[model samples]
Target: MDWDKLRIFHAVADAGSLTHAGDVLHLSQSAVSRQIRALEESLETTLFHRHARGLILTEQGELLFDATQAMSKRLDAASARIRDTEEEVFGNLRVTTTIGFGSIWLAPRLRKLYANYPDLSIDLMLEERVLDLPMREADIAIRMKEPSQADLVRKRLMDIRMQLFASPAYIEANGMPRRMKDMTQHRLICQAQGATQVSAGAMLVRELMTYAVERTLTVNNYFGVLQSVVSDLGIGVLPDYLQQDFPQLVRVLPEVESNEVPVFLAFPEELRGSRRVQAFRDFVVEEVVAYRRARQIAAQ
Candidate 1:
């Protein structure tokens, strides 16, 4: 089999568009099309079913893609091992996490990581959808819940909970709810039940909705909910970790909270020897330790 042709085919299959594949491969669309044609002729089979919308992989294409995907993963594993040779960490590191956690917590502390490794490029993907680490969709993931995927090296970062909070101004104006039933007197700002969120967080919001509050504001993510709460919109169901940065938010009905949600940092087994991953993991661990120690001191 032609390795060059296979590489082009893999890129087209991964991108599902000749133009996109060409752009990524730094070749013209015509050049990419010619290469695909040659590969199809050499294999004596149609790899992709051409359509107006985009290309779809045929059975033959799927088979080839599967092999290519495995090869890609192995190459990545080898690359990671090679990167462990030097103490210097300088390369693109793709990290994924929830929007709330990334924007509220992780993004603020990234300066230190950059300071330590000035040449490092960090791509922070903040979304609720969990990217497949093993598939190389993301190099590392900080998830709100324990990852169940196999062949992942995981670490528990901390325990988080969904609790009620409102800005001081909002609480002063609306009056804090003393009981669950009292929530009916105030507007409840939360991530809508329909939004993509952790099961535990969704359950917490769902339980809050059961109170049949007359006025409510439902946003898609915690960041939006927090924004509304801080603007004096209403009481928000938010993660406890937010309190560290948003000290102006006052806890409401402290007794009413969700079961603990475990925050975890995870990476593919392939990245076990990656210096970039090691650097990020150590930085996060150190930050978490300092955060916990500070919290304990505040309590004391």
Candidate 2:
């Protein structure tokens, strides 16, 4: 059987009409019709029944459609693997990551990656919104949440810990809260976009507030919130790793609630065996592991 004719038949069956299939495939309507007819003739079975509304798939057509769907996916995977092997690690890689991490962490390391692989090109897309990997919106993704799709291969890179912190000026201005109830007298900064008020910081504050005092001030970005706290505007929760950047900032509570956000690198499962994808994945894992270890030693 001609694969081209089968491909055309699959498109028409999926679209429900030759005209619609032609529009999708960027082929002439007549060409689509011809291909479908040829496919039906080769199979010696009527795959679709013509109706006033459109074409309806026969029972045989449904079975064929299922088989073709699997076949098409396998073919695409095989083709991608072959291309990856034949070509150098010189193609453009589309990477999607969170804005803060992309800018502060990944961007700096990417220069070394480029220096190592001079032929490789990268397109970094930094956004808060998660892109669809199955839809091919991005080639690779660095995300806090692990993707649930079975078609994706995910590797946990690191654990990011959240901590409550405030500048010395803010602490001095409001007076240090020895207990939770004392926080009510001081201002608190929180993220507006977050759904729950019970963040790691909030939980610690609320717990302390139960015995001491409490108050609140919500904001969006961590950097902005930290800046406000530094200027004696209020106190907020920030990533523990970020404290090194602001020497003036101090951990608010000695016994604050801490939670680890798992950082992951994800790619389509089909591309897991591809040479280029594997190479990049290995490089990224190595870099992140080294960075995490160095950070641990520094903290010690």
Instruction: Judging by lDDT against the true structure, name the best candidate.
Output: 1
lDDT of model 2, residue 120: 77
lDDT of each: 0.90, 0.74
| Residue ranges of candidate 2 with Cα displaced over 4 Å | 1-87, 172-175, 193-217, 226-232, 244-248
Lowest summed-lDDT stretch of 10 residues in model 1? 77-86
Candidate 1: misplaced stretches above 4 Å? 15-20, 28-30, 51-54
Q: How would you encode candidate 1's per-residue C-alpha lDDT over 197-248 as one tens digit per residue?
A: 8778889878877888889899988889888988999898999888877877
For TM-score, the strongest prediction is: 1
What TM-score should be assigned to candidate 1?
Answer: 0.91
